[model samples]
Target: MPALTAPAKRLHAAWLASHAEWGPGLHEDGFGLLPEDDVESPAGFEAWLERLAADSARCTYRWITEGELVLGGIALRHEGNNSVDRAGHIGYGIRPSARGRGLGTWALGQMVEEARRDGMDRVLLVCAVGNFASAATIERQGGVRERCRNSGADKVWRYWISLGQPAEGD
Candidate 1:
C-alpha cells in the first residue's frame, strides 16, 4: 500500500474545501471518510457507512481531490452488474465545484483501472439520456452506447467497458 503523497494530499484538501456541503466528511478518518460518528444508531447512515467501510465486495475511493474537496469518487460493485446486459459496475460523481472540468471522465477512467485491479470482466455504466455530460464522459472513456430505454420516467443510456482489456489509456 502507498501512503497518500503530498500532491495527493493537496488535491484532497482542494476537494474538501470545494465541497463544503460534505464538510464533516473531511474530519472522518481525517481523509473524508464521512465521519458519521455523531449518529449512535446502527441502522441508518452510520450503519451504512460502517458496512460500507467493512465490505470487501465493493470499494469506494476518492479518485482525486482538489483539496479536502472531493473532485469526484469511484465506487466498484463486485457483483459486476447482474443484469443481462452487463450494466456498468462503477458509479461516480464530481463535486459541483469541479463540474465541467472533465473530472467525471477522469474519475471514471481511474475506476476502470480499479475494476481491472478488482478482477472484472467488464463494466456497464448507465447514464441519463439527457445528461450530456455523462454521455460525453462515457464516450471519452470508450463506452459504446449500447442502447437507450425508459426507466420509469427518465431515459437511460447504457454503456459497456470490457474487462481485462486495455482501456483508452492503455
Candidate 2:
C-alpha cells in the first residue's frame, strides 16, 4: 500500500516476478487463477504478468529492510479466507532458488512480527505433517506444536505461537 522508498525496488520486482510464476500451490487468497507463467506459452507469460499486475486482489505487499531487492521472504496476513487450507496467517516459499538458506525461518519471524503488529495475541499455523521443512520453519519461529492429524492424504501439524509471553526456547 505504500511506495518503495529505497533499495526495495528490486525486491518488489523480484517478488512480483516470482508470484507471476505461481502454480497450483496454496496462496493467501482462497481461490487461485493460473499464474502467467503456467497459463501461457513462454511468450505469453509476459502478457500474463501484465494481467496480474493490473489486479488489486492479488496479495497485499510489504517493503522489507532497505538494500535488499532479493528479499528474505514475502509475508501475508490471514483474512481467514484461505485459513482452512493452503492459506494461513503465514504462507511462504523461498523462491525455489532461495531455499535451504534459512529464508523460510527468516520469513516466519517476519510474519510473527506482523502478527504482533496486527494485535493478535496468538496465531495458528498448520503444515502437512510430512512437510518437515515447514514444520521446522515454524518451530524456529517459536511455534509450539500442539498436535498432528490426517487431512486427506496429507498429515497436518498444528502449532500455536504465543505473543503474550517470551518466545519458546528464548
Candidate 3:
C-alpha cells in the first residue's frame, strides 16, 4: 500500500463519481468537510484544495492508494467541527467499486493511528443509521457505539474508539 497523499489530478474521475454517488452533503474525511459545490468542476476543486492547503485550516486530508490507484480517503480534524458535534473527529469513504473489501476498516485504522500520533486518546466516528457496513467497520476497530442521534435529516450511530486499545478483529 502507498502512503497518504494530497488530492491530485489523477483522482478526478473516481473522486467525481464518489461525489456524485454520495450526493447533496459533505464528504467528510479527516480533513475538513468538502461541500458538494466545492468539487463541481476542476477550478472549484482546485480552489477547494487551495483553501484546505491554507495553514489556518484545521484539518489534515489524505487519500489512501495502492500505487497510482486511489482506494479511498480519510480526514482528521484538529479543531472541533461544529457540523456533527465535537465527537465526530474523523470521516472517510471508499469508492463504490472498492466497497465490500476490508479497505474501509483498514483505512479507518490508519486514520485512528494518525489521531493517536497526534495525542488523541479517543476519536468519534458516525455512520448513517442504516449503514451497517460502516458500523461494522467502526466496530472492528474497537469502536463502542454510544447512541444514535439525528443530524439534519438523517440519524447516525456515533461510536467512540479508544486509541490505546486494540481492535477486536484486527
Candidate 4:
C-alpha cells in the first residue's frame, strides 16, 4: 500500500482501466481514487492526480498494489462531516479480478491501523445492508454493529471498531 502520489500515476491508470464503475461513489475533489468525470487526455489525468495530491484536508487515498499491479484503493477521511456521516471513515474497493482473495480484509485492516496511527482510537464504518461481503469484512476486523438505519434507497449498518483503548462512544 502506498499514498496516492505523483509516482502512482501508472497505478492510477491501471486501476481506472480495470475498475470502470469507480466514479459512482467518488466525489468531486474528494479523496477517492478517481473523480466523477472521465479523464480522457494524459494532461487531464495528470491534472487530476495533481489535484488529488494537493487535497489533504478531506481524506487520504491509498493504492493497494503488489509490484506494479494496482489491485484496489482505500480511503481514510480526515473528518466526520459531510457525506462522511453515512460513509464513515474508510471506503475501499477491489478490482473485479482481485476479489475473494482476502485483499479487502487486509486493506481494511491496514486502514484501521492507519487510523490508529493518526490518533483515532476508535473508528466508525457504515456499509450498505445489501453488501453482505463488506459487513463480513468489517466484522472480521472486530467491528461491532452499533445500529442500522435506512439511508436513501438502502439500509446501512453502522459499526464501531476500537483501535486502542475503548473510546468514549465505543
Candidate 5:
C-alpha cells in the first residue's frame, strides 16, 4: 500500500527518479517546489527540503510512496496566502506511470483528513478545466463545483470540500 511520508534525504534518489518522469519544469504540484528549487543536485535538494521544513508552519508536504519508490506528492496549505488563494488549499500530482491507479484519489482523501484534523472547516481545490482526472478525484472527495475562471489561456475549475461532511469515497 502507498503511504504519505515527509520529505527526507534518504528519498533523494527516488525523488530524482520521479522528477525525471515529469521531465523538466516547475509544474509538478503537491511537492511545493518553487522556481528556485534545485532538486537535481544532492546539496540543492537538501536546501530545498530545508526550505520546505522552514515553511512547515504554513504548509504541509508529503510524498506518496510504496516502500522506497515515490509515486506522487501531496501538499496542504494551512495559511491563506496568495498561493492558497490562487492554487487553493491543496494541490497534488501523480507520476505519469502511476496514473489511472487511483493514487491521486487516495492521496487526496488522506490529505482531506489531515485538513480536518488541522481544524479547517473546508478546503478549496482548483484544477484545469481540461484535467478530467483531477476533477474526478476532487469530486470523489465530496468537492462541490464552485465556479470556473480564466487563468491565462486555460480555464480553471474551482471546487470546495466541506470537512464537516465525510468524503464520498470514505
Candidate 6:
C-alpha cells in the first residue's frame, strides 16, 4: 500500500529515479523544490531537506510512496502566508507513470485529515482549468468549486473543502 512519508535522505536513490521520470524543472509542485535547490549532490540534497524542515512552521510536505518507490508528493500550506492566498492551501502532483491509480485521491484524503488536525476548518485547492484528474481528485475530497481565475497564462480552478463536513459522494 502507498503511504505518505516525510522527505528523507534514505530515499535519495528512489527520489532520483522518480525525478528522472519527471524530466527537469521545479514543476513537481509538492516537493517544494526551488530553483536553487541542488538535489543532485548529497550535500545539496541534505541542505534542501534542511530547508524544508525549517519551513515546516509554514508548510508541510510529504511523499506518496509504496515501499521504496517514490510515487509522488503532496503539500499543505498553512494559513498566514501570501502563498496560501494565491496558490491555495494545498498542492500536489503524481508521477506520470503513477497517474490513474487513485494515489492522488488517497493522498489528498490523508492531507485533508491532517489539515483538520492542524485546526483548519477549510482548505483551498487550485489546479489548472483543464486538469480533469486533479479536479476530480479534489472533488472526491468534497472540494467545492469557488471560481476560476487567470493566473499568468492559464485559467486555474479554485476549490474549497470544508473539514467540518463529510466528503461529498462519501
lDDT of each: 0.58, 0.55, 0.74, 0.71, 0.92, 0.92
lDDT of candidate 5 over 62-153, digit per residue (tens): 99999999999999999655688788999999999999999999999999999997889999999999899999999999999999998788
Tell me the tens digit of each residue's lDDT in model 4 across 54-153.
Answer: 7656777777777676677777876654757777888777776777888878988888987887888787888878788888989999999998898888
TM-score for each of the candidates: 0.64, 0.59, 0.79, 0.80, 0.94, 0.94
Task: State the lDDT of candidate 6 residue by residue for 58-91, as single tens digits.
Answer: 9999999999999999999998867887778999
Clashes of each: 22, 2, 6, 0, 0, 0
The Cα RMSD of model 4 versus the native structure comes to 4.7
Candidate 3 per-residue C-alpha lDDT over 1-170 given as tens digits, one digit per residue, 9 for 90 to 100: 65677877767665666666656666535435444546767887777667767733567778877676666788776656564363377788776677888888888888888788777889888888988998999999999999878877888899998887545664
Tens digits of per-residue lDDT for model 2, 1-170: 11222223334455455545554454522112354344334435454445544542433334333344333334454445453344455555555555586766765676677667666787777877777888888888888988777767877788888867446664
Better of 4 and 6 by lDDT: 6
Q: In model 1, which regions exceed 4 Å deviation?
A: 1-48, 59-63, 80-87, 166-170
Better of 4 and 5 by TM-score: 5
Clashing pairs in 2: 11-69, 129-155
Q: Return the lDDT, model 3, position 152.
A: 78
| Between candidates 4 and 5, the lDDT winner | 5
Sort the predicted structures by TM-score, highest score first.
6, 5, 4, 3, 1, 2
Candidate scoring better on TM-score of 3 and 5 = 5
| lDDT digits (tens) for residues 1-170 of candidate 1 | 11121223324335435446445444221122444433323344344445556654444544445434445555565663343233346666665565787777776777777778766777778877787888888889878888888777877899887767556655
Error at 22, model 4, angstroms:
6.5
Name the lDDT value of residue 138 in candidate 2: 85
**Candidate 1 vs. true structure, TM-score:** 0.64
